[model samples]
Target: METDSKISKKTSQTILKLQQNEITEHAIYMNLAKRVKKQGDREILQRIGREEGMHSKLWSKYTKRELKPQKLKVTIYSLLSIILGYTFVIKLMEKGEVVSQNSYALLTKEVPEAHKIYLDEQKHEEALINMLDEDRLQYVGSMVLGLNDALVELTGTLAGLSFALQNNKLVALSGLITGISATLSMASSEYLSARSEGNADAKKSALYTGVMYIVAVILLVLPYLIFPNSKYIHALVTMLIIVVLIILSFTYYISVAKDLPFKKRFLEMATISLSVAGLSFIVGILVKKFLGIDI
Candidate 1:
């Protein structure tokens, strides 16, 4: 026999989970606010934290229990905000907010206050979207250009060298030299391109491009350097796997930060890079077989 004043067992359980989430987020927002140096950023975080705490208190009345924040989760989001930037961390948290949003809809029928909390969550999203104007996000284009070029070019180069050279050290050395040369070439090209386009900070653009390119090159070339000469094939396999992982990770970051589609972007980049590597490997085999050049 259900009554208006009686909370259902299932709804209570959901409220408990939501209560914990609200409190956890309250702690994360407070900690993140402390870490940032910008006054405006701190204020925005503090406001959000206050709202989260208020919601937690609202939930506490229903549960009749005081719940502590998930300290580990708070620490993790704080560290990520530091290492990756507040925008990324906040947007990642926004992804979870969507699930919470859905739960709010379900709970609305059971609890009248749920609707108001749901509206508050919507406001939170709006606030989060408008609050971040980080400078680093502006250079995402340069980073993407450098990272994509390095992955496609170096992945192909290494795949070809693996078969043609049949020696891990030789492949690694060649890949490193090529990677370095390409990094320099890319940085200079980016500098010139930015300058021609009237960008005020062309040097910074070049720096981001160069740094991302070299980072990708290093990750791609490491397996070759680590493997034994007889395991050139293994190195090639490992390098390909690393390529996919880099694509997956970077694509996800861009998707979350920029609010873009993830699956389509990932599939496109992975397809292009892997296809180039595969074709290069085939070319290497044909070159070795037809030319009869023994390494």
Candidate 2:
């Protein structure tokens, strides 16, 4: 009696597994057929249906149990699977509502066996959505990247100008004007771009970018104020400022991304700064050689 009871339990579990696979296969075949619409649909349906039949045969072989119609379990599982799968696919598709509804209708009429798989997949989708929402800081690296860009470009502009132009009130004034104008222009563009983002945090990104630009510009002009009329000295000062900006940018990046080693970030920032400063210096020398005329 005990052995028979164990066999019955195992047979019942096997039947449930077979039914579940049938429901899943039905959903897959219906979705693929709806999207692709080829004779391959019949082939896919037959292949999956055969797998379900094989599962049933395996259960029969093991326990000599015949497949019975468990009306309640099949009905409940089928409805759940259809609902879950339909909900997920419909939401993901742009104009999927009409297509999803039509597919569901056709599926119910044509492939009733595979609906259970759709429910399992829907559960998986729900789990993924929940995980994404839980990890809100996933895009923080992007914010750090934007900040780094604002710092390097603005500071480099000031540094190159300091190198090329005489370190005097005029150069300082130019830096101030250029910094303010660039910051405002950048902030405005960022605001416009972020207006479509539909989040409070998006506006804050514009503010952060603007602030970094202002800070970088001010740092560039600091050496000029410290050593007035020292044009040669100021060239070295500007280079130092560029070095510091590179360091700060790298440090911020390292802090924001703790997984990245400091040496890697430092070398990366140094390479970029050197490349930019080299180009700017070359341009300045050519301009000074031709335009300054010093004549």
Candidate 3:
């Protein structure tokens, strides 16, 4: 490792930034480790935290200046870990480390230890992959089933109802009734399916599915409820937009956690969902005309 005897001002500033980042990340890992229940996972996070602390020390040597961790960064990442799950927060942090890894390459000439730090960062990614054991992730299929079914079925139902009913309040009322009934039906179906499959946590799986479905129902129906005086077409458009956003968010989460392709999954789900809504819309128009129904 080269000494800082001839380091330039710019190089010193960069070293300080790296030192800050390392120490801040160390705090994040340590904070999350303390929150986790599993001893094995806690130990791994502590080990990584110690490695980050060592990297900060290495940078401190080059700058010959003491560095403090950024409290804000630590707090933000800690909160994200609590809300989004440790696996997601860690993966997100690793993505940031990739940027730091590039910066480390630039500093290798001035600080040879940067190369070693970069290698350790790569290892951290692999370690995180092995440490992921979130219960929600294990039952991702149940959530997916619930979310997708609600999106496709409710979106189409609402679309058809918008045309057939042609009144926003009526449409909202009809949607709420249908959504609640379907949520219960879906929950019971999931419970039976999981039980048949011999899943030990069949009840929990069913609860997750039902909760996810109800969440989707509430989100999709909100526009109708909130804008009951608006045009039904406007409400339908808002609902579709909400559906697309939900698909994007859920697909991105699955992509990051499961190492799946984002674009393909997102496009496929969105296409099927929208296609069903479109067909349902046309059917609604035909039925309304044939039945000569006017509200």
Q: Ten-residue segment with the worst summed lDDT in candidate 2?
A: 90-99
Backbone clashes under 3 angstroms, per model:
0, 9, 0
Per-model TM-score versus the true fold:
0.93, 0.46, 0.92
lDDT for 151 in candidate 1 is: 95
Q: Candidate 2: where is the Cα deviation over 4 Å?
A: 1-146, 235-242, 245-253, 256-258, 293-295
What is the descending lDDT order?
A: 1, 3, 2
Candidate 2 vs candidate 3, TM-score winner: 3
lDDT of 3 by residue, 210-257 (tens): 998999999998988777565788889999999999999999888877
TM-score of 3: 0.92
Q: State the lDDT of candidate 2 residue by residue for 1-295, as single tens digits.
A: 1223433453345344444444444444344334333354334434444544554554354344454544554455345335333222222321221223334334433335325434543465344323322111343443454445655564456555655675545566776787788778776766677677775566666776676567666766566665666563564456456665657664644443233456666767767766676676566567777787331
Q: Between which residue pairs do clashes occur in model 3?
A: none
- Candidate 3 worst ten-residue window by lDDT: 95-104
